[model samples]
Target chain A: MKFTCDTKELSRACNTVSRAAATKASIPALEGIKIDIKGKEVRLCGYNLELGITTMLESKGDSEEDGSVVLDAKMLCNIVKKLPNALTTIQADKKSTVTIKSGDSEFQLVYIPADKFPELPKIDEKSAISIPQAVFKEMIQQTIFAVADDAAKPIYTGALFKVEDGGLTMVGVDGYRLAKCHESIDYHGQPFDCVVPKKALLEISSLLDESGDKAVDISIGLRHAAFMIGNYEIFTRLLEGEFLDYEGAIPKSHATEIKVDVRTLVESVNRVALVVSEHLRSPIKMHVGNGQIGLSCATSIGAASDTLDANISGDDLLIGFNHKYLSDALRNAGCDEVRLQLNGPLSPMVVLPNSGDSFVFLVLPVRLKAG
Target chain B: MKFTCDTKELSRACNTVSRAAATKASIPALEGIKIDIKGKEVRLCGYNLELGITTMLESKGDSEEDGSVVLDAKMLCNIVKKLPNALTTIQADKKSTVTIKSGDSEFQLVYIPADKFPELPKIDEKSAISIPQAVFKEMIQQTIFAVADDAAKPIYTGALFKVEDGGLTMVGVDGYRLAKCHESIDYHGQPFDCVVPKKALLEISSLLDESGDKAVDISIGLRHAAFMIGNYEIFTRLLEGEFLDYEGAIPKSHATEIKVDVRTLVESVNRVALVVSEHLRSPIKMHVGNGQIGLSCATSIGAASDTLDANISGDDLLIGFNHKYLSDALRNAGCDEVRLQLNGPLSPMVVLPNSGDSFVFLVLPVRLKAG
Candidate 1:
């Protein structure tokens, strides 16, 4: 394609599409970003089968010849990034090679034939539902970390999204711990439930931060989901499986309760875990009694213990848990003080922010072998 | 040992020794830091055979007894790093296990026997020479980058130091590029020529900063070199081989000369090199003539060209060079404008700072094959 565009606009479009371009894809054309110019706008698209990103820029008081070429994203970016800030003009010769010219410099880069590019599934923009960008990003941060990375359990590989008449709840569980959060939204009575892959959510979160004063338009299709933020649109295949019933796994009662300073508890547990064996099961015991809570990790090689004075009540008891699972939950809770409810040493413990139970973190305690 | 010391002092000592302790060493003892207590001071030592560091801290107004033990550097550092600001006490029991008590936390860590710790070599203080910390650090930086990394050339793996009555000069070469710098020292009549290992010079440079108030004492023994800076001492073995005669490699005359702004030249060539084939014998060709320099790189697939104005005084000439070697020298030349001296397309070109030849960088040009 022959076009003269602002360097900033070109650079931003290249960066957004390059994220979906796989560095080591078996298909050679997948490594190239497809560029197409038709009416008054130019569009760039990149796809790796699993994920795709497409972005467009409209001409400002200008018009260019309608043409298309698929240039290597990596080499084009390197050249544009190194050139001094200025307007850049790119043109395709009769031989089908692209030339980028700026100041006294000219670069000829080979391009893959645009016809070889895979066809991207068309997304209907009219069926989209818009949500506040801030709320959407926060929900992903709150629940995405708990998603299991192992693909053996396909359902747990993605975050479960449940949307009803009033609100939306997102839940993620990795067998050891579970994180769940809910956000109220203004929507019609369109009810839906789907599991969105963690990879798609992660990429969406990275680009959402820059969408200030703008909303994220999300559309759910029969088999694919699309998120449109700013000039960029990201699409991915919807996960096909049933998620676990996380509500049935959360504990309801407790035998001992303690309220602790969130920062103090997280730092103490992380320090003690440094000496814990990585191969063996990680079990850190917490003794709640009187007016204090004691955190302890005992191993065959060594032991570490830290005591924090807190407001603890109920029966005196000791509970063991996976150190990482508890820390992740406490950090994500986002509260000054957190109240931990323990039923017994063998049951899962419920960790709740002092303010409310809207965000709950549940950790399955490790069973300490009887001496 | 039972002693309470300032947290900052203990942390600094631990960090200095931990640098020498490699986590992937075959010998387990080498992974631990040896802590010895005697008189009013506590000394910590860590080594990995190739290099070693020792740091000492004297006890302030604290209650304690005397003992010796070796603790895992990585583990101890992790615990001490997380502790809040306060003095910490380390106590050893009859069972020989150590307890670190900081604030409300206590960590019991297993230690290797002190007798198994390797002993650091002793260098005579009489064979020492004192130099300004800033000057010594600068000398190492000017030459260390040119040292060859290939194990095949044992002599080129170190910086050659030529010390005489007038002053001292250091030179290093990696077959393609050479860097040499000279500094005035306080050495007397006796002259000494030795090759200091590149690893040792790098450590010494990082340890010594631009503080004219302090001095770095270098003691050259028969087998090892020791550098004592403040309360820390570092030891490294010297390379046992003769360095190449660098003087013969430097050209006595030139056929063409050009003076250009260092920043502009480096940036332009760097951009053009992006399109050049990496690790290839012929990377880029420079055509220098009347007041303008043109750089071009062409592969079987594509080509890029750029031109920049320069102050030229000689006839037109063309030279081929590995773009990376030229870029490295230009980046580290530390000058606003550089004067390039060239003999021919086959001879090495010398790049020097515009003012004087205090620092010299020479790059051997690549020989182009006939078309």
Candidate 2:
């Protein structure tokens, strides 16, 4: 088997698909990226059992015969990136070795048989709904960070996607902090919903080109989902678990509220965190006074305190929370000012963007010990 | 300490001396930087027992001080770096806490007793000799990379600073690679010789100013060496052991010589090393053919090979050596063209700059198994 293609195209395609390649594969062949050359097109496939990524590239003006080979993804990437030439010629020898030559440098790499490569899963695309890439990317970025990283809790490890008469809502909670983003998509054509695993969503998000003008088409089924963008297609196995009713869990109203600058709050938390003990859950206490904001953290190792002038008008209240949650929420809130809704001490608080209704963040307050 | 200074100046000073601050100190007081605010000057000192760093800021310009305090170096650096203004006031309260205020942000840091801070050792100014900072910095950079990081052998962790007969030579070896540099320096009417620890030389190298006109006055005694660069003084304890006689270790002549481009050799080694096994030292076989260079690394996992065109006159020879050493020599050899002087397999090869003098690098070839 013999094939030739542009060095840049091959490198870019392999890199994009190889993100799903298993680092420690139970099946040795799964560690490689499968390459198939048919007529004038080259298809690359990589998978990790749970998810599969496949990308195709056509010859730029020139056509070649059909061929197939499975090359080590890492070695191929390193070699292609370093070779200095526009056109790279790759020819397979005996189906056991692949020869690559660019300019004056040549390399012969061993290849595993293409028969051992895993088969790409099939998805029913009849009920697909097209969505703008920017809308989906923003929703994922705004909510994915709140997903629980632990696999012991299967439901929390995946973002709950609910589609109903109102809109589509994405909700993630790790028990301490929760992030929710709601968007109205063109879903009337075919009502669909699935709880996509955080890892799968991350892979799909990385595959989208933020600068491209193309729209992404997403299709969901009973136990599977497919995302299509340009010539790349991703298939993920939907999680099989019951999602929490996040709307009922969130607080409906608050008695006291304080508006604070998002940037100033994030910076204050970062500074106070420097002196806070790393092992203990970093609980920063917020004391809201007449026209003032006070932040403090005390641990066995050390203590730090800072105050920021603000236009706050309410009864003085004190609350303790994980500094990291507050920092993360403010950093990704995409708002100039954030409203801190307080129910009472020991109760959960809601932080919302002052000017937008699309995103809302919630944090569970930690109860301080009796003085 | 009670003083107000420009945040940028204090930040730069803290950054420069904080490298010597101990992260995990047996003596708790040593973890803090000693700040003495006298009538007209404020002195900051950080020590980890073996080395001490002292920097001074006089009150003649903008800083006004009249007291002293010792604060944790790590915490002070973090607070100063995060504060959001140019002028921050530091004051010692009656409760022994230092208050740092900038704009509306305030941080109260606990301070250790100033009396517990270690005292800086005094150096005899009569024995100090001045050397241009550029020459000193360059000599250290060219030799320190080869020093043995292994602390089991005490002497190997230091670079031999030999001063005799109006010349200074710095030699370092890690058993596999040797870097030696020599330059003539006036001894200021007195001769001295000593071997400074590798860590100390690296620290001094970083402290040297980029301005070419400035010079560092250095003094060497039986147990301590001090470097005075402007208002900063660094004192390091000497390693009490005999250094290796590198003069006898470097071979005098060679059986084959070849000249090659430094950049080309470095790039090829990096590419071929991708397949070299990690546990087994990365040994790349070099075959100097007629006007061509062939490099290959074969392992049980995989094999990678590349050949580049070079101007060569030596007879056909194959030598195996650690690719890292070759890459390092080529990267730091300061010359565009390097002439490799090889003795034979299992013997060390000398990498000399084409300009003929000032520096030399030696790399030992890996003993290959019989084919």
Candidate 3:
């Protein structure tokens, strides 16, 4: 096989696909990226059973070679990344040895037979629905960070993707906190619900930023999902487990309420968190009363307290929390002001944007020991 | 202790000193930064037995109160880092409770009594010698990276600082490589040779960058050396040992000579080094002849080769080396062209800048097994 392509184009494609390649897979072929060429078109694919990513591009150098080869993903990607910004030509023999030539640099890398490479899961195109990339990316960001990182809690390992009529809602929960976000789309397909692994959503969000005005085409199957954005096609196996009733977990009524600037609250909590971080429990306390909220934290290392201006008109109460949980929700609120509703000192509090977009963030207060 | 200062200035001082604070020192007081105040002058000091860094700053906000307090270095630094970019006032009571106020944000922190703070070493001004900051920084960079990191080889843990007749020579040697750099300065003190620990030199270089045209004042005592640069003062206990005879390690004659572009050699060697990195012992082979030099490396993972144009007039021969040693020396050569002198395949090779500067870098070659 012989093909020539633009250095930058090849470099970008290699980087995108290599993210899915397994570094310590039991099967050696899983460590290689399969390159297939047909009629001046080249497709690079990487898969590790759980997740797969592929990108298709034209040869640019006008080569019409038709063949396939699997080369070490890291070796090929690093070479392309360092190659001079010029046209690059790659040639491989029947023995599966590939040579990459660009400017005055030439690299020879051994490869595994393409026949042993795993095939990406097939997508059911008839059930595909397209959503604006901006809205989809925003929804993912507002909820993904709340997902639990512990593998033992498999039910909370992924975000729930529930689509109905023309609206999509994503929910992420880790018992301590829950984030639910909704975005309207122009879709009329049959409603579906699936849990997607957090790792796949993170990779998708990273590549979606460059889509500009483009829309992402998503198709959901019984046990798999596929997302196509720009020239990249990403497929992943859905997380199979029962999801929690997040709606029931959120408190509906509150005795105390406060409307505060998101940026102000984030900064104050961040500073107080620094003091509390000395202790692993991270006890940052907030007292909502009068026209301001007092944020404070005290540990064996030191103590810090700060007051931020806010609009308050409910019962006066004090609540303690893991500062990280509160700061993260405020920063991701994506609005100038946010409304915080608290039922009591021990109840879960809800934070929502003041502009009336459909986003609900709930955080359970950490129980403080009596001083 | 009471002091008012610009938030940014205080933040910079705190960060510089925090680098020396111990994270888990047996003495808890070592984890704190001692803040001493006199009139409008403020000094921030952090020391962990082995190294000490202190910076003096004029209080941007005038405060006549004078006393001292010791606060958790990391906590205070983090709080100041996030504080509003405005004038900040820090006041401490005799009970060691401190209050920091800036704009709408106020923080209260507990501190340790200043009496527990370690005393800084005193420097004798009569034995002090000054060197241009830029020249000293360059000398450190040229030789420091060659120092051995193994504590077992204590003799190679620091650079030998040799001064005579206003000429300064710093030498660093690991078992496999040696680097010597010389800089001429205006000094008339008694000649002295001391080994300065690597950690101290690194911290000194970081602060010297901002010392534009100023000179660094260096004072060496029996067991300690201090460097004062602009607003920062750094002190450290010297490494007590006999330095290796680096001059005897360099060969005086060679059978081959090649003058090559530094950038080209660096890029080619860097790329070939990637292919051979899978093996512990790097074996990048260079064959010099006619008008070009061919660099290549081969391992079970892959093989890479590139040819760079060079000015060669000596015997055509091949030599192998751990490309890292060569690439690092070339990267630090600080010249457009570099000349390589080789004795044989098994002998050490010397690399020098083509512009005839006082720099000598030597790297021993790796032995190749029979093919």
Candidate 4:
């Protein structure tokens, strides 16, 4: 079959779809991306049994014939991207050798039989929920870093996504710290909650339309969820097992409330953490006074202390926490002003943006040594 | 001892001097950077026995006393950078704990006795030569990448620097390729050649001011060479061995001459190398025709061919070369139009800028199997 396509368009499709292709898998078919040509359109699909990505591209030339073949995704994408950005023509033979030519460059790539390719499972679109690209991408970015990478607790590696009555909440936790992002969406369906693999959410966010004007349609099934953007659809498996009750874990009341600049806190913790982390105990201590909060860390190697101007109105308290946890929470607070609510030195600290009550991050403080 | 310094200036001095400090070395003193405080200037020095770096910073406040101590370089730099950029006061007690306070942040860094630090060797500047920073930096960038990284041949790991007859030449080579960069300098001293370690040259290049207006004073001794740029000086041990006769190795004539665009050839070779590298024999073949040169690489996995427009004269020749060698030579050729001179398939190919005779890069071609 002989067909031609725009070089830029083809390159983008190959790159986005290739992310789901299996690498170093035993099955040769799983390593190839299936490309099908019909009339003036070409459809490329990449599936590794668990995850699948499909993208459609409009060919710039008339198709002499219709055909299908599975070609190595990496080589094809590399060749296309390096070729001059001009009209590209790809012609495949019955012998499973695909010839790709653009400008003065030509590549003859061998392919796997198309029959060995796995088919993407279909999701019912009738009950699909639509989400604005910006809303969904931001939610994933705010919570994905908190997901656990440990295999010992597989349930904690996935984020719990819940949508009900125009409200959407994404929760991620690794026991040490929990990140929850609540945003309003245009949804009127029954309340449904699903645990999505963190890897899938990250990949989807990378492909999300950055303009935020586009809407991503999501169809959730019993075992799989499909996210459809402009000309592509990604299917990811739903993680099994019950999720944690993160809402109940958040502290309900606090005796101390201190408001400080988010940027200053992040920078201070990052600096003091350098010296603090060099010792046996990697904890940065926070002491609240009348109108200021002091952050200090002392080790055998070095000692650092930083005082930040804050509005503190509660009993003086001294607390110790892992510097990394505090830094991450402060960075993700996403507002100029951040509120730190504390019950005591032993309890978890609730952090929230000064302007928003919808989003909150809870961090468990490291226990201090008793005298 | 007590002194105050500009936060940014101190941070820069610490970072530049820290490049030569040892990390986790068997000798604990090598991991520390020595700071010497005098009347109104502070000197920071980091030495790893083979290499040494020294930087001076001006004190903002009058010094109450003079002292010297060695501290961890990375921690000191991190603290200085993260602290608020304002006037910073640093004071050290007899116990060797140095207190550094800037704005609202304070750090007390433990230090080792300054007597344990090695003294930087003095360089005689009477017979020293000066070179433009731009010319020296550019020469390093062009040839440093070709330096051998294999420890088996320690001599090839450094670029031979020669100053004679008003010509400054730097040569770097591996077994497969050699890069030579030459420029005119205002040096009329006795002819001398020394091998400067690639690492030392790279570090010196990083600290050189980009404006090119500043002159870098260089002093070469029997065993070490010193490069002084502004308030910073770097000294590195010279490699002891007879350098290779690279000037004699370059071909004086050629059987085929191919003039091609540097960028196009680089991109073409990069793309075709992907497919070529996937096979057992990773070599790209170049064929010179009348008005065009074809580049092709085929393996068991795939095949790619690209033809670029070139002005080819002399007998047509077919040659094979390692893609990396060819790409490196092309990238360092600098000029947009590059001339490729080939004597035979087994002979080394000389690549030069179409208009300049001062610069040359020689690439050894891989012998091809007889057809």
lDDT of each: 0.82, 0.80, 0.86, 0.85
| Model 1 pairs whose backbones collide | none
TM-score of chain B of 1: 0.93
After superposition, which runs of candidate 1 have C-alpha atoms over 4 Å from their true positions? Answer: A58-63, A124-127, A210-213, B124-127, B211-213, B277-282
Return the interface RMSD of the candidates, in order shown, one decimal each. Answer: 1.6, 2.3, 1.7, 1.1
Model 4 lDDT per residue over B208-280, tens place = 7778488899899888889999898899988889888998988888888888899999998888887865246
Off by over 4 Å in 4: A124-126, B124-127
Winner on TM-score between 2 and 4 is 4
TM-score of chain A of 1: 0.93
TM-score of each: 0.95, 0.93, 0.95, 0.96
lDDT of 2 by residue, A23-102 (tens): 77777677878888887777888887778788987664353656777877777788888776788777787747787777
Between prediction 2 and prediction 3, which has the larger TM-score? 3
Error of 2 at B113 (Å): 2.0
Give the CA lDDT, 0 to 100, for residue A56 in model 2: 88
Candidates 1 and 2 compared by DockQ, better number: 1
- Can you tell me which runs of candidate 3 are displaced by over 4 Å? A60-64, A368-371, B60-64, B104-106, B124-126, B278-280
Residue pair clashes in candidate 4: none
State the lDDT of candidate 3 residue by residue for A180-293, as single tens digits.
Answer: 999887778788788999989988999896457789999888778999988998998898888998878988788988999999899988887766653345678898888999
Point out the worst 10-residue segment of candidate 4 chain A by lDDT: A273-282
**Positional deviation of B353 in candidate 2, in angstroms?**
1.2
lDDT, candidate 1, at A232: 89
lDDT of 1 at A166: 73
Name the lDDT of candidate 3: 0.86
